[model samples]
Structures are given as structure tokens and as C-alpha cells.
Target: MSTEEKNPIIKIYMLGRFALEYDGEIILEDEGKIHKVWSLLGYLLANHSRKLGSQELPELLCADERSGDPAKVVKNLAYRLRCLLSDSGLPKETYIVQSGGSYSWNERLNYTIDTDEFLASYKRARQGGIDEQTAIDCYLQAISIYQGKFLPHAVYDQWAAHSTTYYHRLFTDSIISLYRLLEKKETYELMLPVCEKAIGIDAYDEDIYRIYIHCLTKMGRHKEALLSYETITNRLYDEMGVNPSGELRSLYREIMKTLKSVETDLIIIKEDLNEGGQAECCYFCEYQIFKDIYRFIARRVNRTGESIFIMLCTLTDKEDEIPSKKYLAEAMESLKVSIGKTLRKGDLFSRYSHSQFVVMLPDISYENGYMVGKRIQAAYKKNKVSKVVTMHYKLQPLDPKHF
Candidate 1:
């Protein structure tokens, strides 16, 4: 048997986590130790195809420390890395080679890198004239290989950051291409899991969520699609302090439209409408729903000649400065509850910003609106809310002509 057959190739995983697999045994870096050892190893492996000068390694690896002799530190790190490889049962001499004051990963070593294979598979998948199944198989392989960002441990490193971005873009593109191909084949169910996995990898990616929701809707799972949309939108708002994109919002509307089935029984429709039970106070809805209510009320004001006032409640520090995120979030929740309990049942309210709430009051005079705002502030203070958080309100008349 050849030498290659006698020993299995060393497998290095830089995605999600950095690990080494040799002869079916996993090797991990020692935590809380000198990070340069592993950092050097990762850097060399990342640029394995090219030779890196010893002088350059010192600057990159020891950029923060100015007290030591950088070249000497790098040399010692190299020696320590080789010892680590040998201790891990890898042929140390066959892995990292030094010549002319430079180091390079041994090209002839029996080794495989997950990233190299990932890129290679992706390139093959994109080649012209390949059969659809072959392309799909390549894409699936590539996706499976990319567990997460490239070398997450070295994410802050400039080189690693660039590679991470490139690989992630490629991975997302692969998912999109795979789903489009599945759509062509009329096998949307198969696309569901792929899109779902992609979302788990990058939850903030709206495009992946859009595709996943589309697949769910395509399979007649409108409820699941709607739930997914709600879950993502809530998460986005809570974490990023922003709403979903227009595309995702439009998708949500489409899902809601699909969920509406023609029901002959008026009783069933009424029950569905009152599923949340009678409102004890103001109607609290999502911002989008609140906007819809605003428009409807604006149109009605022209005919009924009823006055409507919109109040914006803002939370700030004692000095009128925006508080910290944690404090602001807590104060906002308290403000929401206070407004809900203080406003009338016909009133509408929604969160307008990270530290603001917009409330709608109909059939109320301007003076009454100001009084209502004060009532909300009093309720909020009576609940023993943070003293650092102070409430401020401004009232504006909702003009029907603007609608």
C-alpha cells in the first residue's frame, strides 16, 4: 500500500470552531493558553497555498505587544506549534515547512481543509453544462461543509474577516440557487429544510426568511408561514430595533391573504375576529396595524366631523437624554403597559421607536388629549417605574385632508 493509504489525511475544520482531526481523533486548542500558537497555525493554514515571511508573521501575530522582540517571539511560536502538531500525532515536519526565513504549509502533506473543499465544490456546481442534479448535489455538499463563518475564532483578524464574508456570501448564494432549482422541479417541500437551515445559520437574513416563508406557503402551510413571519419580525424589532423589509412585509400580507378562506357562517367569522377576547383598554396592535387604523380613522373624520389626536410619548433621562439601551427597553415596556391601562378601549397605540410610543385618541378634544397624556405619565410613575426615566408627550391633530 502507498504511504497515503497507510495514514489518513489530517482534517482541519476552521468553520464554526477550530479543530483538527487526525486518524479519526479530534484535537482542540488549549483554552487560556498563549493564543499566538493557534493564531499562527490558523493564519498559515488560511494562506496555505502561499509562503508567508517570518518577518510578516511577527507583525500580524504580535501587533498589540510592543515590549518583546517580535521576530524571536514568532520563532518560538513556530517551534511551539510544531511541538503541538507532533503531540497531536501529526507528522510535524510534513505540515509546516521553513525555508529562507519564511514558512509555508507543506503542499504534499496528506491533509484536507473544509474551506478549500467548500470553495472547490461551489465552483464546480457553478460550471456550465453540468446536469441539474449534479449541480444540486455539489451545492448540498458545499452547504453541509460550511457549518458557520470561516475561522470564527479569528473573526477579528483582517484576513479571516475577509474570508468569512466571502464564504458567507457564497453560502447564501448557494442556498438561493438550490431553492430556485427546486422550484423549477416543483419540489418546494425539499427546499423548506434547506431554507430553514440557512435561516438558523443567519437569522438576520431577511432573504432566507422570505424564501422559507414562501416555501411554507407554497406547501399550503399558510399558518406556519405566518408564524414564521411574526417570529422573525418580532425578533428583528427586539434585537435590531427595526422593522422587516418591504419585501418581507409584502410576503406577510400575501400569507395573510392566503389564510383567508371563504366562510359562509357569519358566526364563525365573528368568533375568529374576537379570538383575543374583548379589549379591556386601548387597542394595542403592531405598528403596521396601527398605521392602517390611522388611515381608516382619517377618512372617517372627513364624514363624521369627529376630531382625532395623535400623541407621541417619549422616554428620556432626568436630563432629557436618551437612556442606555437596557434601561430604555425596560422603561418602554413599562410605558406600554401604563398607556394600555390608562387609555380608553376605542383608542389605538403602537410602539413608534426604541424609546417612543405613538397613541391615537378619537372623539377627544385637544385639551382632553393633553390631560390623557398626563394620566398616562401619572400611571407610569405610580407603578414605581425608574426615576431616571421621565416621560414627555406631544399631541398633534390628525387632519383628514392629509389622508
Candidate 2:
């Protein structure tokens, strides 16, 4: 409640390397043993000007710490940061404000924030036009401005949602732009590295894998492309206990056929390339469709490190006895007929678990993934099942070499 601490000089502080001011002239830097809690404050402030309550601040700061009361640590850190800011001649009523149970920054303070400029420029560039080079330039600039992931050292905080979202947008946009440019130029070699980097940042992104697959095919690396299917297949099986989407499976088959040119020998030569096969568990019965799917993945994904695909499902509260064998059999028939009409010949679908199923497609990207999911959902809807069954789908692209 003291006037001295009422409105401490506010400065735009970036939470990277060490807490450093982006715009303050009389640079107030902390080099000696910087408390994790102090870093946590910088993490919260970096998000936006918000009233972080006293009760909430400590919890946010100490969320990852196992051995201390977050409340006490947060209070001490705030007091410590306040002294440092004041001693460094930070503007009065600028840096931070302490209210009853909260702490907030004065948003009106004048300061040159790299983050602000980066975001503004990025927004402007993207709004320019599709396939605009200016947008590409601004996106690179934004990537540079991102010192590190928002609050890299700050274990955890509830306010990190915004920063995470913005970071991903910038990253995804950059990758997609590069993909388009590379595709136009036919620079397969150059496109490979960029797509790799994007996948490293977000492995679950299907677009990255799709781009990789396309680039590989164009570059005449058909065998490698098929091998990649195995890697991604294993990953999805491990992480989500599911497989790639149906579009990808179709792509895989198409690529294989393209790789093996037809000969006039009148003899069908199957290239020993890895692939999913139809199961004979049920002859003439469509209920074996789900079984065929898992068997397909099991045959193909015989390696490791690609375990990020997951299948999550929730059953309707009422009439919940995981679909019986007969019901599943009926659903399989419906799915086979539905998918047969909607999907290409080679698409693969597997049972992820009791309530969920996965459709795997090797080279298909977002466009096909969306189409596949929508059609399948529609099929489930149009068919009159005995119970209220709902399925939600998520698609992930896996690292090809990981397997």
C-alpha cells in the first residue's frame, strides 16, 4: 500500500537468455543467480497486460517447483524485482503494479517492444495477399524476433496460451509459405530441409509430412517415400495407438504403383516395398474391415521413434456397452460400404480401440484429411445405428526416418 511501490517504472522486458529490457535506456540487468520465480514474472508479463492476482501469481510461478510454497516464493520474487527496477531508474508507474491479490503491467507505458513490432509486422505481411513475398519476409522477421519459445525457462503458467498460439501460427505460416514457393520452383532439395525443420517443431502436423512426401516423389525418391510410411505408421501406433489417415494410405499405394512401372512381361512383380494388406479374417463379410486395418499397420510399422499418433474417443453416457461383436460387425459393413464409395480403393482404416477407429493415409495432407473425416462422419450419421455413437478425429504426420 506504500506510494513508493504503487507505480514502479515499467519497462518492456523479454523473457529470454536473461531478463533484459528491450527498450529501456538505462539498461537494468540481472546477472547474478536469477530466481526461477523472477523468470516466471517475465513469462506472465510477456503474454499481455493482465491483473495477475496475488493468490494466482504465486501458484503460476511455482507451478513446476516441487519443494516450496509458490505463494511465498512469488511474493519474495516480486519484491526483489521491484527493488531492482526502482534502483535501475525504471519509470515511475511503469513496470509493474501490485493490487490486492493481483499484479499487472501498465499497458500505456511507452517502450519499443520487439515482440510487439514482430507481431504487427507479421500481421501486416500476412494480410497483404496469398503467395505474397512480403508476407514471407515478415514471417522470417517474426521468427527472428522470437528469441525462444515464450518463457522457455519458466516451467509453467496459465497465461502462456496466447504466446503458444501466436508462436505456432508464425511457425506454421512460415512453413506453408516456403512449401508453396519451393513447389513452384521445383526445388525439391531445398524444400526437404525446410519441411524437416517444420516437422521438428511440430511433428504431428500432417501438412509437413504431405509436403515431404510430395517433394520426395517429385525428386524420384519413391522407395524412400514408401519407407517413410512405415516410420510414420509406427509413430502413430505408439503415440495414439492409431494409424495415419485414409488419404495417406491411398497416397502410399499410388506412389508405389508409380514407382514400379508396368512391364510387358505379363507377370505381376510385387516390389517388396512395405505396404498394408487386406485381411482374410472374414471372407465376403464386411465386418473384417477394422481388423484388416490393424493388421496392415502391424505388417508395415516394424521400427521405432514414431509414436506420436493417438486416437481418443468417448462413448455416449447412455447404453454404453462398448459396441458388441455383432454391432461392430454391422458398423464395419456400413463403414466399408460408406468408405468404399467415398474413399479411393487403397485407403486403410483400423480400430484404434473399443470406441475409436483410425484411418491411415501416407501422403495425404489437410485437404484430403478433412474430406476423409467429414465423409466418414457423414457415413456414420446417415446410417441408422442402434445407439447414439459419435467419433471425433485428429490427424498427425510422423517422422519418416524415426522408424
**Residue-wise lDDT of candidate 1 within 31-60, one digit each (tens)?**
525577888888888889999986788788
Cα lDDT of model 2 by residue, 292-362, tens digit? 55445544554542232322222221365455443554554465455555555445555444345555554
> CA shift at 172, candidate 1, in angstroms?
1.1
TM-score of 1: 0.90
> For model 2, what is the C-alpha lDDT against the true structure?
0.57
Q: lDDT values of the candidates?
A: 0.84, 0.57
TM-score of 2: 0.48
Instruction: Name the runs in model 1 displaced over 4 angstroms.
Output: 1-3, 29-33, 89-93, 276-278, 317-323, 381-389
Q: List the lowest-lDDT window of 10 residues for candidate 1.
A: 1-10
Top model number, TM-score: 1
